[model samples]
Target: MADGSDPEYVAYVHGRAAALRRTAYLLCGDTHQADDLVQETITKLYARWPRIGRVDNLDAYVHSILVRAFLDEKRRGWWKVRLGVPPERPAPPHPGVEERAMLRAALTRVPPRQQAVLVLRFLCDQPVADVARALGCSEGTVKSQTAHGLAALRRILGNPLEIGMAR
Candidate 1:
């Protein structure tokens, strides 16, 4: 901390920084965003540091903080706001750009956690274990979120996107 955060918190964060960054990168898929996630997580840990002595597994507690920080960021969508003109997003790969556009719109409508799981699992093509690790949740949760995300996406898409269609 610039003003001197908790010494124990600083030490723990310094020691485990790389591991935390890897986990954050897995969650958000960007180095800059991962850095932000870690900063946020550490700030949160400092707030609870005095009472954190009772925590049985400190690593797990730190991870939980990181996950919540990531989830909260997603929910708040603060990053969507920018000071300057936003950079244009690259075109999606699908031949039917309109379909992909609609899908993107639908994705925005999904619950934040479900949307995160879907993006990491499908768009990022991450394995269940990796997604689980990134989210600090169980593989079961990843699978269920995937299922629920797909259902929500399909429902939003309506007749344009359907099940049992060949590619």
Candidate 2:
């Protein structure tokens, strides 16, 4: 209802919120934290709607915002505060849940920047150039991060042969 309130911006947020939340969840491995990241990113987008609307790839721009938000959250010391252990819940009775859990656990062990690179490149299916632009790094840095991320994942997962390093 303010000056920045525009139909296109509303539509863009409506359309992309779920995807952004999913990406955030992958980065943080916690649904509540992911929601916070998405909310922060959306708040930023609303404040910069005029400028962001003119970008060639709005999705990429928003992704860059989301990734940066996650990184910034990591840099803050408050993120390390945990009051108590969460209640354990049974895993979903679905196929591939174990594999998904394994991958996610390994992902959590990776450094925040490398985790962002892996999530953007593999999970979001972003190209090296786009990822570099999003992370404000060079293409070569992205590539190196991807390699290191994968290697760390492999080491955590404990199967160098099983995990195929493709793309």
Candidate 3:
């Protein structure tokens, strides 16, 4: 740190960059945009790195930065431009890929706060308390957002259980 850069920050970012990028992708559903989010998060983290030692959970702190960056971008609405149709990615050969793709698409339609809650609690398998801490909200709020988010997803995707019950 005395030499002008914190080695811990460098190592931390190097180790977690890919995971953060993946989380960003989940938040935005665009690879290029996800990269931008990660870059924004890393830049913010570097600025605050000197105080990292006092933090309780470093990963959660960094994740909070990434999510906030994503939410900020969504609020600005500058990335809505269509530079022509997006290129189609070759579908993965997994059996549930279609379902996952559908879910991802629906997720983008959900409100940002709810989407963040769902991604953190279910996708990342973080505890309710951890998610609350990362989002800077109460656990009750996280739980409520998650329920609303899931309901939105179910409505968007058409609940399979309801369909089966009707049959």
Highest lDDT among the candidates is held by which one? Answer: 2
Candidate 3 backbone collisions, by pair: none
RMSD list, candidates in order = 7.3, 4.6, 4.9
Evaluate model 3: give its TM-score: 0.76
Clashing pairs in 2: none
TM-score-superior candidate, 1 or 2: 2
Query: Model 1 Cα RMSD, Å?
Result: 7.3
Q: What is the lDDT of candidate 1?
A: 0.74
Q: How would you encode candidate 1's per-residue C-alpha lDDT over 5-120 as one tens digit per residue?
A: 37667788899999888877766656899999999988887888778877776776777678778788778663353327553456767556655555555666677788778877
What TM-score does prediction 1 earn?
A: 0.55
Where is model 2 poorest over a 10-residue stretch in terms of lDDT? 78-87
What would the per-residue lDDT of candidate 2 be over residues 1-167, giving only the tens digit for each residue? Answer: 22344887788889989999999987887899999999999999988987764677777788899999998887644323332655244686874676666666567667788888998888778899998988989999999999998888877788744644444
Instruction: Report the Cα lDDT for residue 4, model 3.
Output: 24
Question: Which candidate model has the greater TM-score, 1 or 3?
Answer: 3
Give the worst 10-residue stretch by lDDT in candidate 1: 78-87
Alpha-carbon runs more than 4 Å astray in model 1: 1-7, 76-110, 115-142, 150-167
TM-score for every candidate vs. truth?
A: 0.55, 0.75, 0.76
